[model samples]
Target: MRGGAELSRHTTTVIAGGGVSGLSLAAHLAVADHRHPVVVVDDGSHPLDDRTWASWSDRPGLLDAAASRWFERIRVHVNGRTTVIPLGRYRYRVVRGSDLRSVVRRYTDPLPHFTFHRGHVDRADQDGVVVDGDHVRARWVFDSVIGPEVPPPSEAQLGFRGWYVRSERAAFDAETPTFFDFRTSQDHGASFVYVLPFDAHHALVEHTSFTASGALEIPRVQQEALTEYLTEVVCTGGHEVEREEHAVLPLHAAQAQRRRGNVLTIGTRGGLLKASTGFGYQRIQRDSEAIAKSLRRNGHPFDLPEPSGRFRMFDAVLLDVVTRESAQLERAFGALFRYRTAEPALRFLDEATTPPQEWKLFAGMPAPVYLAAAGRRLSS
Candidate 1:
């Protein structure tokens, strides 16, 4: 809604795109002792509560109150074998989008320093953001809207379709979540099915694929694949799909860095999602905390720390293998879950391992495949 009579406004900070990243930043800023005037702008374009975010963490934080479920163990299926890996200190947690959004709103809505604007942003820079033909001026801009575009060369897409289903019989391992099951057809790419059971008869069965260069499939195609997966490997017939959810994540894409002047980026726009695996909740949390700390200490949000360099290199190597040579992935991942050395591998993925621990875990990996991938990465 724009009017011709000098449509101009101002705030201490302008946050564009009210998705997970934008809302999370606002929540943190609203809680600080010395609060700044913040305005959150959104287009109301995409449905917010359409996906579930899952991550593995050793300890709960501020976001744990919204958790839908958690598991202490994971079962990985590969090459007609099931390997049960225990999460000794870590717990695999699932949080629904609707619950997360509600949590953020509850904390930020009552704060007098925060305001939410419903408008699509037209442009954003170090100066401010433009929404619906009106320029919103700000001293600093924390933008989570403009992100790196997916490149054409082997642009990997992590596509998933999940269904919350109920079975007529008791037919699920409720205590454990199936992290990955490679029994499905891999014609599209390295495909698998993941099951997160709510109880003996209710579960969220998801069919996922990792491929290079392709848009997400239509709803019918995704449904057929999920149904086929359920009948064959997961459970028997006589199960009804209660609800469906789908999402697509780009892998090995470029990252956004803090820009010059008074602009900073956060969340997916700032490369919070891990390239090898589509996990970003914890990263976004850590980033938001850092931003809040920066704002509290220096009265600005641009002086935040970057992710570890070693972890970035490791991720790049794994992404190269996944995009260039995917046939060896099932074996590669299966080796990581072996009973003898699963703990260090999990720690490595969490980016919490020491150099010695990382090397020990790397020793257990498919050395030849990763070595080749590493060489290619270095040369490139």
Candidate 2:
């Protein structure tokens, strides 16, 4: 404590970042408990922008009605062939940042026990969060300010650059989305292009890479990739880009700090982002809900389910393969999708598959690389 610094406020919970993860936990807590107030603190440096979160679900989700697009099948390009995987009971949905912000606000804004505290947090811990030399005391703190906690020198990073585009004529099939088109150069890393078509003339096409180098090309390279794809692949004569979005996410084995006293990390910082594929929307949702249920039922949010050890091994090995064999990323994925069905793969990636199911899925994979990677990880 500074000589003159004092406790500025006291709340039941202090969320250190007002991004999706922090606000999500706040909303969950506020709804589950009425006596305890939840406060979300933020620096507001990041304004809501063109980012989108995409996930698939067998049942309806909180933001499904507001989703920007939906697809029931995924088309994959691998080994000079195309494979279409049908999602039997699941549907893929893309939710925009603005929509997610509004949805969560509708849940927190009207509650008297909920508050949105604005300012940059200098420090956050179990005792409270310090902002502008004033400390806000709280019983618990959910921190999402990642900083340097993720993508350590040992981890891989996923980089992306994409555009929301409108073609001059009918150039896309609105019903299906290209989950992965591994036609891009692999010199940088495991790179692929994906298209989320909203209609015959409009889509959000992007190029994403999983790399250990953590490097991405901007206007020159990104623009060229899209131009070539739209012209040759989409067979389009002309197109206009409505918006461009770029981002990077850590691809590392997530180690959630759930047992820590009153200071718990959430979201990407908490290891909710899957290390192998870089997906996290559904994982974050599951974690937030579990945390709230634990707090409501057990009087503590730390009562959460443990991640499977096998999945941890799987994620680690796949990440090793991605980094070691960047040039054959498509081949590894192709082995998994050889069944022409995506439901099992989705469940496996979601970490909900059983041992037998997992075995069947991996049996078709060309396993020499995976075995070597697994051996190295296990020995180390």
Q: List TM-scores for all candidates, in order.
A: 0.88, 0.91
lDDT of each: 0.74, 0.77
Stretch of 10 with least lDDT, candidate 2: 1-10
Q: Write the residue-wise lDDT of candidate 1 on 1-380 in tens digits.
A: 33312224537687888877887788777766536678788888865776677788777666677788888789889878988888888888888878887887787878766778778788776577777876777787777786433322333678888899998778789898898888776655677789998898988999877766565555665677788877877665579989977888776544555464676766776777877777788878778878888889987776677567778777777766765666666766776676543565677787888998677656656778788977876787
Q: How much does each candidate deviate from the true structure in C-alpha RMSD?
A: 3.1, 3.2
**Pairs that clash in candidate 2:** none
What global local distance difference test value does model 1 have?
0.74
Off by over 4 Å in 1: 1-10, 148-155, 214-225, 258-260, 340-343
Q: Model 2 shows how many backbone clashes?
A: 0
Q: Which stretches of candidate 2 lie over 4 Å from their true place?
A: 1-7, 146-153, 213-221, 254-260
Positional deviation of 225 in candidate 1, in angstroms?
4.4
lDDT of 1 at 273: 81
Q: Among these predicted structures, which one has the highest lDDT? A: 2
lDDT of 2 at 113: 70
**Model 1 Cα displacement at 316 (Å)?**
2.1
Best-fitting candidate, measured by TM-score?
2
